[model samples]
Target: MTHQVTIRNTGHRFPAQDGSTILQSALDAGLVLPYGCRDGACGSCKGKLVDGRIDYGRYSEKALTAQERAQGYALFCQAKPLSDVAIEAREVRKAGDIQVRKLPARVQKLERAADDAMIVYLKLPANERLMYLPGQYIDILLKDGTRRSFSMANAPHDDEFVQLHVRHVPGGAFTDHVFQTMKERDILRLEGPFGTFFLRDESDKPIVLVASGTGFAPIKALIEAAFKKGVKRPMRLYWGARRPKDLYLNGLAERWVAEHSGFEYVPVISDALPEDNWSGRTGFVHRAVMDDLSDLSGHQVYACGVPIMVDSARRDFIQNCRLPENEFFADSFTTAADKAR
Candidate 1:
């Protein structure tokens, strides 16, 4: 059976097959919905169930609490319609314009960015190009039928090769191989250009970019894209790590500050040792943002990081900082361990 889903805000309607997720159905019908970590680990797809019933499929409690479910909110990425439904969600435009494809790529280079991070560069077929928004991610298909996701660190204009900053997750099948054995010229399969973490170029508000660890992958792409397009809006970046050595691209970020008059960079360390002689900001990365900007109501925040950081930022910014909830965009980096939990 098929149920009709009505977008109450836009009056758009789509047909969803039984057991099919609302997000998949919307995409199937050529409509785009804001989403991240489609596995239901991120709440980016959460919206009001204006009417009707849904399975409210398996999801992380952090993504959708019981209270939120009771209030008629659903994670469209995991929600399956039990009947015709009406939902109030923001319609994303332009995302559906680029097609998602599976392509073969050759590992062109592997540079050790840090003790636990590897920077990978993959070259596509001679005539092929992946047209994607700055902050989208691609899934690396593994031989065991599982997939590992990583954001493209290179901007669209700098697409000669796809770049990914992969942090070594010890004991992880994919990351272990990437660190222990994967080498230059090896072939890998990839599919995607997924997520809704890109900048909302239409908004004129100043931008606040928050990132932690490898989450900087997509943020790096976003900043380069903005610069390529000559976006003049004031931008501030807050990047956090456990120690000074973990800030792998510190020099690059510093160079961006030196070159761009409208851009500023802040590096925060949470667990610095005395021998490291750290003098920069110390504490949670998001907390650093909250401390510096008492008022985020007039700014648009784009955050990418571990679920905890992303979730905390989303909650505190809206509640205490008076930020408009709709202005916050995020892509939560859910690891395999996170998914298992």
Candidate 2:
């Protein structure tokens, strides 16, 4: 049985096949609702269930609380409609309006950005171009039917080749291949550009960009795209890593600070060793933000990287700094271990 699903404000309607989540069906029908870590770990797809019944599928308690569910909220990514359903959700317009596509790409080059991070450059067919918003990600389709998601590190304005910063996940099949076996000219199929973590251009609020480890990939894209569009809004980036070596693109960020008067870069190292002789901010990256900017009421924050860092920033900023809930955007990097839970 197929159930009809309607978006209350937009009046957009789609059919969800039996057992399919509302989000999956809507995306298949060309409606892109905000989402991250589609496995129900992120609350990006949470919305009001305006009408009709649904089977709320398995989801993390942190993503959808008991009180939220009792209040008629549902994680659309995990909710399957039992009947004709009406949902109230903000529809992303400009960034997600483009069609998702699947295409083949060849590895143009691979450079080691750090001991654990590899910068991969992929070239599409001569006539093919991927039109995507900054801060979106692509899922590399593996031969074994599983997919690994990596964000495009390059901005859309420089899209001659897609760039990805892949961290070697120990014992992971894909990362193992990328680090040890994958070679230049290797062909891979990919589907993208996904996620709703892009900049909200309508807001002129000063921006605070946060990234950790390889989570910096999408943040890099967002920053580059913002600069290319000549957005003069004050932008500050707080990049957190375990050690100084992990801030692989520190030079690039420093150059941005030198060239752009509106831009500021802060690198935070959490576990700097005595040998490292780090002389910058130390401690959790998000904490560094709180220390410097006591108030974030008028700022828009874009955060990506580890789930803990993203979650911490979202909670602390909204609870203490008076940042509006909607003003905080993030993409949490969830591993297979996280999904298993």
Candidate 3:
């Protein structure tokens, strides 16, 4: 049986089948959606149910606690509609452009950007192209029915191949393989071009781009795509790391600043080792943004990083800096452990 799911604000409609997840239905029907972990782990796909009931699949209490579920909050990745439904969420675009396909990809090259992060470039079929927005991600299907999600570090038009920034998580199943046993030219399954955290071309408001650790991957993609499209809006980037080495692409970002007149870069270090002798912007990177922009009422923010950092920054940006709820876009990279937690 099929029920219609109507998206509020945008009025976009999708189908919800009795046995399928809401997010799966949206994608199947060629509707763009906001989502992260396809599993019940990350809360990025949480949507408010305006008018319907759903049987929810297993989910982390942290993502959607029992109390929140009772209050009409549902995780789209885990929820199945029982009847016609209405929801409120940002309308998806290219994510709606075409149906997603599960394709085999060959690893073209792998380069280490930092001690913990690797930039893997993959070559897709010559005739097939992945049309995705700037800030989306893909899940590499593993051999054991598991997947590793990594943000696309390169934007759409530059697609001779897809680039992913994979941060090595100690003791992680997939990451251990990536760092230790994975080899170039190995065939892997890739399904994606997911997430709604992309540049809103409709808004020319000043942009605040923030990142911590490898979350900088998608932010870098967004920035490159923005610059390539000649998006001349004022942009300020605040990137934080523990030591100077953690800011892997500091030189590249500095060069970007020199070339891009409308862009600014702020590398923030929270714990600089004495050997580094680093005296730049220090402490929480998000705080650095607060220090500069006392009023964010007129700005749009794009943040990618750990959930705690993204959550904390979002709270402070809205409550203290006067930013609107809708003006902020984020993609929280939850660790595999965080996912299991």
Candidate 4:
């Protein structure tokens, strides 16, 4: 059984399949409804149920309090329509729609994902939550007023711990500390939810996600968010690293490919040694995309990584592959070295 869902302000209507949450069904129908943490932990998906009944699914009390429920507010991420329903929700069309915040987070855990990469998990204060779009980054404030920026690796839905994939730079101050001394329970001040490098939900075009090294962090967030939102658009991810081990989360990406129908993952290694025994695609990551997708005029690309890869992909895709200039979105991971140059 399928029921129709109507947006009160937008007048857009889509069918909610039986047992599917309204948010999931809306996304499947290509609607860009406002949402964060599809797991019912964040109230960003909270909206007024204008009409019709719904089975309010599992959600944290803090997210949808009993008082809010009495007032007709439902966490759309967890609400399944029992009949034709009309809901009031503000669609997030731009980064400006969400607020930027400054908060303190405790380093709950730190584990090395690779020889040069550390996966850092941050826990925000219990009474606070950072509302951010997938693919946005946060800045860690240093005592000297310098800031180190890192993308949030975890999707908004998995916000119990804000995750960051930090690559250690040999002589860099912040990263050296992260590699040498950063420990669990260390408190750090951070500001943001910054950057416009998020998904343009309004577009229904197939997506090409490119990442290099730790740039995979935000890309990971975007992919997880898409899965939770029920986005069915075809997506192919190109993750490039110098060696197989540098593709630290290779297993996780492979799992996504095995589990999802319209998703594909290609791991490219540029400088694999004989010991690495690499059998997969070789060469530059962006070039691999170009070789396979000669025609990208109808596609959208989200790229993150070092400046060279991001710049090359943006230029080549638009010039050679006929991809539209506006369709290219990127965030270049610039280090102190790059800035010096």
TM-score leader: 1
Per-residue accuracy of model 1 over 1-341 as CA lDDT, tens digit each: 99999999999999999999999999989888999888887788999999999999888887888999999999999999999999999998844578999999999999999998899999999999998999999999998898888999999999899999999888989999999999899999999978888989999999999999999999999999999899999999999999999999999999999999999999999999999999999999999999999899999999997889998999899999989988999999887666563
Compose the digit string of candidate 4's lDDT tens values, residues 114-225. 9999999999999788888899889998999988889999999888999999998899999999999888999999997765578888899999999999999999999999
- In candidate 2, stretches whose alpha carbon ends up further than 4 angstroms from where it belongs are 9-12, 94-97
My TM-score estimates for the predictions, one after another, are 0.97, 0.95, 0.94, 0.72
Task: Compose the digit string of candidate 3's lDDT tens values, residues 161-214.
Answer: 898888888888988878888899988899987778889998889999999999
> What TM-score, to 2 decimals, does candidate 2 have?
0.95
C-alpha lDDT values of all predictions: 0.93, 0.92, 0.86, 0.88
For model 4, state the Cα shift of residue 244 in Å.
Answer: 0.5
**Candidate 2 clash pair list:** none
TM-score of 3: 0.94
**Pairs of colliding residues, candidate 1:** none
Score candidate 1 by TM-score against the native: 0.97
Ten-residue segment with the worst summed lDDT in candidate 1? 332-341
Report the candidate with higher TM-score, 3 versus 4.
Answer: 3
Task: List the candidate 3 regions with Cα displacement exceeding 4 Å.
Answer: 8-10, 94-96
